[model samples]
Target: MGADTVYVGYVGAGAITFGAPNVLWNHSERIEAILRTRLAVPVIVDPNEARFKEIMEQKGNGDYADSYKETKWFSSPQEAAMGLDNETKDKIDFWILAAPPHFRGTTIEGRDLELEMIKLFGNKANYFVEKPIATTRSDEPHKVAPQLAENKAVVGIGYMMRYLKVVQKVMSIIKENNLRVMMVTGRYACAYKECHKTPWWMKSQQGGPIIEQATHFCDLMRYIGGDVDMDSVQATTLEHTEPAGEIGVINVDEQAIPPEDRIPRATAAFWKFDSGALGSLTHIVGLHGIRYSNEISVYADGYQFRINDVYTTPVLHVRTPADDSKEQVFSYPEDDMFHNEFYAFLSSAIKKAGKPPLPTEDLLSTEFLSDFADASKTFELTWRIRDISDAHADKLLAQKAASSKKASA
Candidate 1:
């Protein structure tokens, strides 16, 4: 690839979503950032005809849409791959695999695109893939990890929360003070009634909320407190039938979904980190309206860091022994974490391709954070929590059944 231009191949468009009125979500923000880059020319590749038509119809609706008006479009991954191979193999610098989780393992034509990219371009196969690598317990990513290691593919997993300025400040403080993290706690609460009535409601499809939504916090917990001791993980959840008011009911029609396929209304999980630090995460869907409350706190020996309002104006509160334990607050009202994540990946791609470095300093030193193997670990953690919580729910059901049998006898 030349230093003057970067040609990118983007896999999916369904990840783009709207939050508030005329306000794009984080995924959309990422696409906007990529499109706005001076030297990047991206092409959209998707197999869904309906989605393609929908995006075309809505192309003039927002700034993000307007930026991609003249972009190329492909109907399938194979078509895009062939076109790149034939025309711009040397110029193809990076790929954005933003497809749905289920499609990540194998596309519509049963192709492992990530592995194919490695085989086709080797080390030049840089990618920015989305989270929860796979929806189901697929071994494709596990199989591809060794090849990624061999080819040294520059891959960046989409855990954008780590790029927040507040988060960076926390990391700097920890590094400067040589703080040994003692505990990390994260809470994610949102309104269930306001959730979109999509396939996300089906646990079998979306892998439940913990895997789909709360995975962000899980990754952050691992980032702050070292790797987790997977065997020490434990969890419990509030089932839909537990009680009326305990778990908020979805306003969407769910009669088609069977009882077993329904997701938990609330889940609480805790784990022991390899660093001897304890971590806990709670996700509750009982709030009202579209407002969401998300926060995380890290506790060290003599220092405490608490981050609040992650979705809106992020604020970091610090308490240290040197300050007489008085709270010091710092606010970042206009931080674009999604943009930061995109720019980091692009800069790394350019550097790895031997092109002249961009003016912006590289924010991440490593090839990538949350690579395929690391993302697989986070994926395993979420499934482990779901499995344990399901077991707890099963025990409760069995005990209730035994009591009913004894009373009838």
Candidate 2:
């Protein structure tokens, strides 16, 4: 390979990057195609010894794995950095940070290691960090976002739902029709399986389902409908796990846990947008199966529209007086949103020097997608809902206590 060949490095080898149906699983074969026919980049993955052996065993026997045989595996990025000579380091051109959401923090060694890689790589490499960029407790984005933007680095945050073709089409319709937004509603009722089967359901670990999972809807609420007014949000959460209510006690290996009690069973909240339009969210992690029901609706002055089964089977429906009060439906059942999103990042990251202008900022120029800064706004809202909801629950408990005292008197 030539010196200019973009060497891709991955920070984490967990479910999001390499697990079935995730970024690598769905697109590794396509990455092979791109490598063989289009680009000649090498991929380096850093997983601990155990995970490294597991990946080699699981993926090595497959035919496509041969394409990745040339891939270099390391126990950690620091090991790779030390093993590679300065000349070899210059070939490294992109880093993909896909660590679990909870492991991402300012002081977390794993996350700090990736940041050191970014600082070491500098403008020489681009980045694609997955979201929630930082966990609720860490506040790492505040520390990381400035570093990337200050370097004028090319980066992409994994708010890929915004890249859904159906989502874009609906937003375009809103613009073309000259609609004034009035309200937006989003429901992300999903099963335990869809949450990747582990600490995801634990609020302490993954910041609950609202910040970790349902955040996509919250981001879309800002993108399609309008900005959220932080002062106007009212929210509450519910849990149903017996004996360990509000406390996560199930081990990662436990398979028979009640879905609702594992994380938050349900969180119902409403917020007023800066435009004075109302926005509401209903997130429940209590379904069964791989295909969870996800939908978002937008109601404007003269239109009512919705996108349903957004994660799996994306369909759009519109209702207007001009249509005789009938619904106009649109579907993009065959769209591979993940592949499309990865390819978009690849286009900008793989560009030749001085050929044409490319996106030099952390956020891509892609429509409706969020960068770190944009995502922080939504993360802030999630915490806001959390605080308000907890307070409300406490207030109710206090009232009940006061009533009991009066009855005893």
Candidate 3:
């Protein structure tokens, strides 16, 4: 690594499995594109040796065949954080912590790998961390927030939706008009039968669908509407039961896991924003096949903006009284939010280094939307919604149990 070159250390390859189109859309490609640098042999760190080997073997078959070939590998986050030579560590410009949420934690030696890397690299290397920060009920992120802030680590979370062109346009309109958002509504529906067969199906693993999947829309709501009043939040969920044709029923074997550990078929939640705006979100996992429908609409005085199909083809529909109430349609079929987010992050990192000046407006405009501390608020909100939903389910169960006992008596 040299002054002119940028090196990146990837913590996990799970993004390949999680992202659409597999390896092609993984973070590595985007990071490489932003840095304008290619790794002759990329370094990948993962604890699962067999899985890594499988990915390596399948390298030559996918979209970016040559991009998949790599050499440097580490068995654990600790190994990657400490095993790399001092010179290499100092030279690495960025780190992509794409490990699963459960695995993003301190090592057995009680060293926080992320903080350790920040310390080892002298806090120069920026970090791009994945979302849901943690799946379990943990205060680690809250505890780590101060340390990261003290270190001035520029960490970005994986809420790429905030970087979408349509989203940016909506924000611009709101800002230009000085519109006070009155309400925000988000709906996310996914084909549960076709996808989400992995650990995502377990509540204990991924914190249910709201924390794992619909958190994106939740983040967007917060991004557009402002911080949520946590105390004002209320949520309800549709749980799976013995009924055969229930919405919660999925193709997977339900008997493998206890019903309590499974995720809900649908969840609906609403709350008041700190700005006194109302916000609501609904997530349903009952759809079949591989199709997904997602939309978020913002309402203000005499204006409405609805962004639809965010994952595939994003289109924003606008209705305003200024134009005699005529609807205006804007489509962004070629927009790549993932690329836009990474580019913004890498550009921010580069600017911090006093490198060549890049356009400041769009590059860092939405940076706060995905910063670690800011993202933690969204993460905590998702967990709060989960907790509320869980409490409601438990109350119902207790009532059912009491009724059963009385009937037996």
Candidate 4:
């Protein structure tokens, strides 16, 4: 909260840190990497002390544990906010809202709470929050979106994939070539059975696989193909007690989710972009670990471009003339996209303050990445898919109920 130092406030500590059950979800390493780049910055973290202590114990008496305990820790965000004076709050430079997507009040209310915490900063501090931007379809992301611009703070949604070097190179090519996009296809498949443990298995908690995990590809699809028309979107979902079972089988515990609330094992969504480009996304919670393919392919007037495994190892391939006539490949073997993402944020924060000088890449790259407004559109599309699928299922159930009553009569 000072001219010489930046203060960071973290909400929902463990879920954003190494404490998450899925190590893939952990982002402590990225946060630590950011801290190293900035000088005299301190983080105030709020979470259950027991979970923090558990993480420390799990790491043994190593440097990580020692570093974990060094930050100012509190029990919860409310307690920390209450303890901080206005002057201290003013000194806060950044806020990271990393709470679990589903916990704290489902995805909708929980995300609202995350934004509410940032609003506590008086909209003066730059903030970064985790993705799937909104939890529920009903959330009015548009209403709060203007606050970021009014506050003049660099607010970013955690779509770190946009910062990948390979992605950047491909974007550069697309920009330089002035290509007209025709269609975009994306696939995000993962082993949710292994990654999802407890609360995550519930759709109410996590918004299902399409909203929570595959959203990265959804964002990418929009990024490459441009904005989508909400009404033009059509989606279908499939869930089974036995994925390999009969197609018409229907089984559920009494008074449970009525089929719509179940965590879908597979989902396919299609939508038309404002550019008139057709976009389609398929997400399957099958396959384990790196064995699954995560890629986004774009077909333009003169070229075919793709980013394969954007999360793990980003490899971009380009086929010019749009016919696979000539092929080119670009690989980022040591891409630290998370580090790049934070570095961009810190750079933008510093630039806004005008106290320090940093590289231009930071400012330029962050400028290119999707902010709350841009990411909100993609979130809305994903949420709409779930809503449409649920409505269809509900209609079927109603029809079935009427048929049963008539038969009994």
Candidate 5:
């Protein structure tokens, strides 16, 4: 009780995933080990799932190790929340809302859980929701915008790449170069197709792969594009879902939902930003990114920045003039997304009125993800990026120009 040991709890620690929420059912022990090793904190497991029992089962063919047998467990998240007293809760600093099933393949359900958690932890300063805060619609942020304005509670929707050191450097270069975003393209893929799901995510009830899985890149696209309004949007999904007709599926099944329509094998949405920046996104199945990587490429004033395997320190291929063509590996200290991401939430919640770890304006990051999810499920979304326009967007250009204005003046 002396100085407040930040006893943060992972609401769904067992749901630690691979790539994008993939290893949930099995990686709890390993994830905990990583957290313990890296963050200097114990990541306790807490879930009502039968999978929690596997820790103490045995280490033979299908069992876990002895050390993990002691893996923390709880009846529910609320119980875990209540266990942290005022002193502990105050020190808790940030609440990480992980749990793969909650966020996987569905934005609406994920948002519902987020709203529920929001209501549950009313006074907490920050909470982390995974990508695609809303799939069916993104007005939720608009709904909560009041709370943000009133209480100033910051919500970090796990767009961890935004915090990467290399990305930050490139963004600085873009801002410094007076460059305008002319064209942007991105592709996010996994090694295999979205073969199966927890039933909830695949159906329209939860949301679809685009929003749940692909939202990460969508948000990154918007982030790199300087938050311009997404316009002239159009996309198509793959008939990859088990039940082909399910919306948003690119390579899972072939049957359509409502047993009528036929989905495509992938989806692409092409649009223009308010900064006259054009964006094209392709979220497909079986087509992994570069080197089986995740990629986002941006073309601007005679230059380009390609970020591949964006989960970690993405390889930044900067294309400049013949003499200046150099591939600089931008450095990022916070290699662990989960750790830095949570640290950001901690800073935002504990230190109010400062530069937030995550954006507090309009939940734009998650909304970008929501668009793809919504697009896949509903097959179309009327909602597009709101504030960007080509007219007086000269201001953004001015920001770019001002960096070099003195040199030219």
Candidate 6:
């Protein structure tokens, strides 16, 4: 495999799951599959390649390895990076960090590799990080930015939906119409906390729905509604059944929590963005993913784009252009969204330039929006203003200042 194209090296378990945690998950696999067809050689798979091999050994479940049977494997991602050093004669186009589990936040385990990859191969290759870039918004990681810049990190938070063709069209419409997003409505349902197969509902440490799953919707909120100004946020937690005592992994401490009383439900609020766009997001693991599909609708300029089961193709929706009620259609072109997303990250890496030529305003906006979920007994908002030249920064700042005054008034 030469460096003509980016190679994917998926690590961890969730990626190993059957269908998808999200539609783009499957879409990414399909795009990679398509690329494999058009390319001279088959694409590669690193750590995930071995994990599936192990699973097929004992459980006889082919689900994990089936799609990626011919795929390559590396000992660890770093080892894979090293292998590629020789594998491609050091002409790697870019590397994909599709690791899961860190969805909640970075772990103490193998923490060294994260930074080491930045320091050692920092410039050796460019890479892409899946969305929710880190376990949480830990500024501590940016301390390593110089090394990251040296490494030529053309990294992206894989917020595939923002780049969806229709979504982009919506953005174009907004800019074309000079529309301002006023509100967004979203809903999701899953089985009760007791029925969680992956135990994601147990606690945020385990990555309960909102941060782990609903993050895409959060990003879309910003994407469709423009920026947000989170004024205040509140949440209510539920603990009807504490840890129905299931024996577990290193992260699961069944002993500390009694089998009968594990708290699993929480409704949250986020009222804080300089943009002052109010947002409402909710999630419940008590319902089945099959029983409920994702919903997103934006209200702005007396126009709305209603999308149902938005994750997959045929994004269901009713659109309005000022006067007309709305036009509903099916099988709209969303695959292009995934296609653009793929090229955006790869091109950024190849060109060695600014944020993916497509800087997902959606992802950047949600980066702070979800922190509204974690309440600290105090109404809170957090921010870290980046250093930038004054040329146009002041104008954006002045607009926010005027907007804030109007919002307060």
The prediction achieving the highest lDDT against the true structure is 3
User: In terms of TM-score, which candidate is strongest?
Assistant: 1
What root-mean-square deviation over C-alphas does model 4 reach? 4.7
- The candidate with the higher TM-score, 3 or 5, is 3
The parts of candidate 6 lying over 4 Å away from their true place are: 1-29, 33-73, 77-89, 102-109, 112-114, 136-152, 191-198, 226-231, 237-272, 286-289, 313-321, 324-340, 347-409
Candidate 5 lDDT over residue span 1-409, tens digit each: 1232233445664434312244423333333332332221223435554654543453222322432432355655555556545544444445556655434323254345445555555545355555444444555544544544364455556566665555666677788888778888988765434455433224354444455555666666777774545346655444333354234433434433552222234556677766778888776545433234578898887787888777745667788754455665554433544444444455455454232233242211211122222222222222331112211233444665797797798
User: Candidate 3 — which residues are off by over 4 angstroms?
Assistant: 1-3, 15-24, 37-43, 48-71, 77-85, 105-111, 196-198, 242-245, 357-368, 403-409
Give all candidates' CA lDDT scores: 0.73, 0.67, 0.75, 0.67, 0.49, 0.47
Ten residues in sequence with the least summed lDDT for candidate 5: 362-371
Worst ten-residue run, lDDT, model 3? Answer: 102-111
What's the CA error at residue 45 for candidate 4, in Å?
3.5
What are the per-residue Cα lDDT tens digits for candidate 6 across 107-184?
244643345555445555555555444554444334434445455454445666776656656666667888777777
Question: Of models 1 and 3, which has the larger TM-score?
Answer: 1
RMSD of each: 3.6, 5.1, 3.7, 4.7, 13.3, 12.1
Supply every candidate's count of residue pairs whose N, Cα or C atoms clash at under 3 angstroms: 0, 0, 0, 2, 25, 24
lDDT of 2 by residue, 216-308 (tens): 888888888667889999997665533323333333553455553345567899999998999999987667666788889999877888898
- Model 3, span 105-189: residue lDDT tens: 3332333655765665667877888776765454667667788889888777879889988999999889999999999999999
Per-model TM against the reference: 0.87, 0.81, 0.86, 0.80, 0.62, 0.63
Instruction: Between candidates 2 and 6, name the one with more favorable lDDT.
Output: 2
Predicted structure 1, TM vs. truth: 0.87
- Error (Å) of candidate 1 at residue 148 is 2.1
lDDT of 4 by residue, 1-409 (tens): 2354545566766655564655565565665555543433234454578765565566446434444443555676666677776866776667776776443212244446545565556667777777756555535666557765666646678897778888778778888988788999988877543453544546777777777777788887888788998899887666554354123312333135544456666778898999899999988766644466788898887788888887788888999975566689898687788777777776666666565544455213744277878877877877888778667656666787899899999
Candidate 3 local lDDT, residue 41: 30
**TM-score, prediction 4:** 0.80
Task: Show model 5 residue runs off by greater than 4 Å.
Answer: 1-4, 17-85, 99-124, 134-136, 189-194, 198-206, 228-231, 236-263, 286-293, 311-313, 321-336, 347-409
